[model samples]
Target: MSALQAVAKTSAPTPEYYFQEARAFFDAFKASQAIISYRKSLLMTPAAPQALNNLRLLEQSIGRMPDGVKSATRACVLEPGNTALQHGLTDALLSAGEIEHGQARNFWRHLKPEILIIRQGLPEEWNGGPCRDGQSLLICHEQGIGDEIRFASCIPDIQKRFGGPVILESDKRLATLFARSFPGLTVVEKVQRSDSNPPTAQYRPLVEEHGIGRYIMLADLQSFVRPSLEAFPRTAGYLTPDVTETRHWKDHFRATGKQPAVGLSWRSGMRRAGARHNYPELQDIVPFLKGADFLPVCLQYDMSSSERTAIQKASTKQLYIPAGIDQRNELDRVAAMIAALDLVISPNTSVLMIAGAVATPSIGLHSERGATFLGAKTDPWFPEECSLIKSGDGSWSALINEAIPYLTRMLSKGGRLK
Candidate 1:
C-alpha cells in the first residue's frame, strides 16, 4: 500500500460523524440519503441502536418494509426493553405482514397512557383477548385524527365478535360523525395525544359514569380484529355520513353536473421534518385543476392566500370550496362533502381516511408506508373504493402522474372504480 493511502485510511471519519450526517439529511427531508448514511454508520458500529431505529423509520416511511423490519429487529435486539424501540419493531412487523408475532400488540405500552383507570372494569383481557359479550370496552384516544379513523376500520369486526357496548373517546371534531356512523358506540367528544401530557378531563366522566373499566388503545385491537389479511371486512366504507348533509353537498355539486365533482387535499394538518415528501405544492396540483373531466373543489384546510390565488390563476374556471363548511372542525360535514363528491384526491392525509370511511371513490397519493397498508399492494381498509399511488422514494409528482389511468377509468361513463 502507498504511504499516502495508509495516511488517508488512518484519518477516516468516525461512526458518530456518519450518524450526525444522517440526522441532518433527515431533518433536511432527504430521506433516501438519510437511510444510506444511517446504514453506513451502523456498519461501522453495530451497537448504534439509535441509528438503526432512525433508519427503520425512514425505510418504512418510504415503503421499504423489508429493510425497515431488518433495522427495527436489530434495534430491538440491542435494547430489548426500550419501549419506543419495541413500538418501532412492532410497527415494522405490522407493516411487513408479521401480525401474530410476539411484539405486535400493546406495543404502545411504551407511550404514556391517556388516563389511569381502576382495574375493576374487566380484568380478563389478555395481551390479545377473546371476544367478550355484554361487557364495556373503552377505546382510548391516541395519535392524530387520521390514525383514529384508520384504526376505526376494526370497530365493526370487534363489535361483531364481542357484542359489547363500546365507548370511543374521539376528537371533538370527529365525535358527531363517529357517533352517527357507529350508532352503537358511545362517543365521548375529546382529543388526547397518546398517554402524553394531553388531558382528558372533560371526557373522563362518561367512562366513570358508565362504570366502564377496560380500555384499549385503538391500534391494539388489530392483533385480534385483523390478525390476517382475510380477517379485514370486505366493506366499501364503514362510517355513515348524515343522509341530509350528504344530499345537500351532492346537490351543490350536481348544479354543475356537466363534470364529475372531485375533492382535493394537498397537505397534512401539521408539518414536521421530512413531511414535505408526502405533500405537493400549490403549483404541483395546478395541472389537476386543468383536467376537463372533473371540477376540482378545495378541501384543504389552513390553505394560504398565495395557494388560493394560484388555484384561481391555474383553472379555466375558479376552483370551488364548499360554502359554509369548516373543513377543520366540522368533520361530520366534511364526511358528507367527501361522500357527495364523485371522486376524492389527496395525499396520505386525513381527507383520504374520511373519504374511505364514507365509501367515496378516492385516489390517495402516499409516500409513507403506513401500517394501514398491512403489507398489501393497495389499502386493505377500504380496498373497494380507495386506490393508493405510493411513491416509495418520496416522488409526489410521479405519483400524480400514476393517477392518470385511475382518473381515466373513474371518470369514464361505464366505470365506477368501486
Candidate 2:
C-alpha cells in the first residue's frame, strides 16, 4: 500500500486516542486545548466519566467554573455510582459558590467515606513530635504574588513547629522579596532548583514526592485551623518608602489641590491571557470621576510618559507624575505613597493588596471572574472598610458605574491630599 493508504489502514479512530490526547494537553497546562480534545472524546464515546472529569477540571483551571460545574454534574449523572465523579461534582459546586444547606450536607455525606479512610490512617500520637525534629517539610506557594506575600507569614509558624529549616518553593520574580520578607527560612526559586532536591514542581507533584508528611501547602494554612487573620503576626509599619523619594511625590500630589486626592490603578499584571479581558480601559473610569480631584498614580509597569499623557488627556482632572518613581524597583515606595493618599481606587492587583495591608481606605474594582469568588463586600484578606465594586455581567462600563458612588463617598471624607 502507499504511505497515506498504509497509515489510513493501520490507524483507528477510538475514544481512547482522543481521551489520551486530552490528558496529555491537560498535563502540559494547555487547558483550552484540552477542553477541545476532551469534548471530542466525549462525542466519540458519550459516557466516558474520566473524559468528563478532565473537561470539568480544565474548565475550572481556565476560570470557567460555571461550565465546569455543568460538566461535572453531567459526569456524575453518567456514572452515579462513581466516587471520584461525585467528589469532583462536590468540589465544583463548592468552588462555584452554589452550595445550599441540603447540597452542603449531601456533599459532606458523600465525602464521609473518603474522610473516614484518611482519619483511620492517622496515627494516635501524630502531635507527639520533637520541636526540632529533622523532618523535611516542603512549603509551596500557590496563586499570585500577593497571595504569597499574605501566606508567607506562616513560614515562621511552621518553623516554630518543625524547628528544622522549611524549604519554600515560589515564583521566580517573588524570590528576593520573599527571602527578605521571611528571613532565616530557605527560599528556593522554583525554576532554579538543582536536582539534589526535587526540582520545583506544582502542588500535587511536590506533595506526592514529599510523601505528604509534615508538609503544608501555604494556601491551606489559613483553612487547616480555626479561621482568623490573627494567626499571622502583625508587623506594624512593614512597608516604608525612601525618605528622600517620599518627600518629592508628596509635594507633587499636594501641588494639585486642597481636596482629598485619590490614587488610582485600573490595571493589573498583563502576563496572563485573561488579564486583558478583566482589566477595564482607563478611559472608562475617567468619565465617572467628573468633579472629584483625582490623581492618576499609574501603578502599571512598563508605562511611558506618552501613555501617561494620553491618559491625562482623557481625564477631566490633571494627572500627577511623581519624580524618581520606577514601578519595578519602587513598589515599596509606591505602596508608601498610596498609604499617604486619602483613598485609593484600583482594580484587583498587588498594589491594592499592599494598600489594604497598610490599612488605607480603597475602592476596589473587581471583574466577574474575581467578584464571583470574592463577594460584593470587602475582601476577607484585606480591611473590611474598603469598598468593593463589581463588574456586572463582566462589562467594563458596569465596573465604572459601580466605582462612581464609592469614589464620591471617599471624596466626601476629607484628609491630606498627598
Candidate 3:
C-alpha cells in the first residue's frame, strides 16, 4: 500500500493530524489549502479551540471578515473563558459592520490600562453615553496614523454634539497636521517615539496639565458619532492644506506643461505580511497610465532607486516626481501636491486617506484581503469624492481593467485627454 494508504489502514486519522496539516499549509502561504484542512479538522473536532481561532485569523487575513466573525464567534462559544477569542470575535464583528452588537464593547474590557489610560481626575469614561456640554474631554489616539486620520472625521460631529473643549493626543508626527486640520481642538503628542520608549510619566502632563474632565479613545468615537452609515460626515476634505505649499506645487506642476497631472501611489509602507497583499507591483498599473491626457506623479513616500528605475521604464507617459519633496516627514508638502492633482490612483493606505481627506477625486484600490475595504466597496471615512475599486482574488490586473473605463470617464470631465 502507498504510505498514505498504509497510515490510514493502520489507524483512523485524528483531528490532530488535520490540524497539523493545516498549520503546515498556512506556514507555506497556501491559505486555500489551510482553510480546507482547518475546516476538515473542525468537522471532526467541532470544539477545537486552536483550529477555530486559527481559521478565523486566516479568513480575516484574506479579507473574509464575515467568515472570520462566524469562526471567532463559534470559538468564543467553545472557549467562553478565553479573552483572546472574545477579542477576536469582537474585532471581526466590528470590521464586518456589526458595530451595534453589545459584545463588540467587550473588546475594551481586555485592553491593558497602560495602552489607553484615562486620567484619574475624570468624572467618568465616555461609554456611548451623553457627554455633558462644556466638559473637557481628552481623546487618546490608538492604532496607526491612518486610523487617527479616519477617526478624526468624527471630531466635527463631536463638537456639534458636546459643547466641550476637545483635546486630542496622537502620534507626535501628526500633532502639527491635526492642529492645522482641526482648528479648535488642542492636539498633544503621544508618549511613545519611533526610536525609543519614553517614560509613561511623560504622558501624565497631558492629563494633569489640561485638567481634562473626561476621556475617550479614538475608535470609540465611532459608537457615538457614527452609529449608522448615514451618520458619517458628509463633507469631503476635513483637512486643509497650507496655501503656500499648495500654490507652490500647483505652479511647479503647471510649469511642466503636462496636462491632467494624476498622482499615483502603488505601495503601502506597512511591513506586516498580510498588509503586503495591499501593495501591487507598479507594472500592474503601468498599462492604465499609457493612455492620453494623464501625467502620472509618483506619490510613493520611499520609492527605492530600483523601483524608481522600474517605474520610469514602465510608464510610457511622462511621470513627475517633485524633487526634494519627502512624502514621509513632510505631509504638508504631500497634501499640497495632492491638491495639485487632477486625480489619484492608489491602494488603500494613508495615501488614500490623505487624498480622500483633501477632497481629491481619487480612486482607492484595495486588495481582496485589504482591511480598509468595507463590504459595500465604500469607505465610511471618506466622502463621495473617493471612488473605491477592489482587486479580485489579489488580482491587480483585474482591478486595473475594471478601473480604466471609470477613470477615463473621470478624466474626460476636466483633464486633458490625448
Q: Can you list the residue pairs that collide in candidate 1?
A: 112-195, 113-195
Residue 252, model 2, lDDT: 66
How many residue pairs clash (N, CA or C atoms closer than 3 angstroms) in each of the candidate models, in the order given?
2, 0, 1
Give the Å error, residue 72, model 1. Answer: 1.1
Best by the TM-score measure: 1
Candidate 1 residue spans exceeding 4 A from truth: 1-11, 20-34, 61-63, 109-135, 191-205, 315-317, 392-394, 413-415
Query: Which has the higher lDDT value, candidate number 2 or candidate number 3?
Result: 3
Question: For model 3, what is the C-alpha lDDT against the true structure?
Answer: 0.71
The residue-by-residue lDDT of candidate 3 on 1-418, one tens digit each, is 1443466578987787778777766655566778888899899989888789898877876767789889998998888877677776776776576667733464454353334333233345766544565567888767676777777878888766666688988777667777888878898877543322321323445666777768877777777877766777666788878888888888888888857788888888867665545667777878777754677788888778888788678766745778987788777668778887888888877878888887787777765433333334467677644444442223567767777876787898763222
Pairs with steric clashes in candidate 3: 134-163
lDDT digits (tens) for residues 1-418 of candidate 1: 1443454477885687677777767655677887888888888998988889999988887778888989998998999877788778877887887768733554555353432422222333433444354557777776688889989878877766666677887888888888887868888865432433543234355556766546777767777778788988776788989899999988889897677888888899798766766677677776666554777888898788888887787767677877897889898889988888888888878998888888887877777656667777778887645455554454566667667777778878422674
Regarding lDDT, does 1 or 2 come out ahead?
1
Using all chains and alpha carbons, the TM-scores for the candidates as numbered come to 0.85, 0.58, 0.82
User: Which parts of model 2 have CA positions greater than 4 angstroms off?
Assistant: 1-130, 134-138, 153-215, 225-252, 255-257, 288-291, 304-306, 369-377, 384-394, 414-418
Better structure of 2 and 3 per TM-score: 3
Question: Could you give candidate 2's per-residue lDDT for residues 1-418 as a string of tens digits?
Answer: 1332344467974677677776666544466777887898899888888888878877765667789789988998998887777877766765465534213323333243423212111112223243334544666555566666555545656666666656787776556545655656666665333233323323445434534345545654444221343433433223334455556656767787666657767777555655644567767667555745565555566656776777768765656555676665555566567666767777777766666655667766765333223221335455423544342223566657766766676667652111
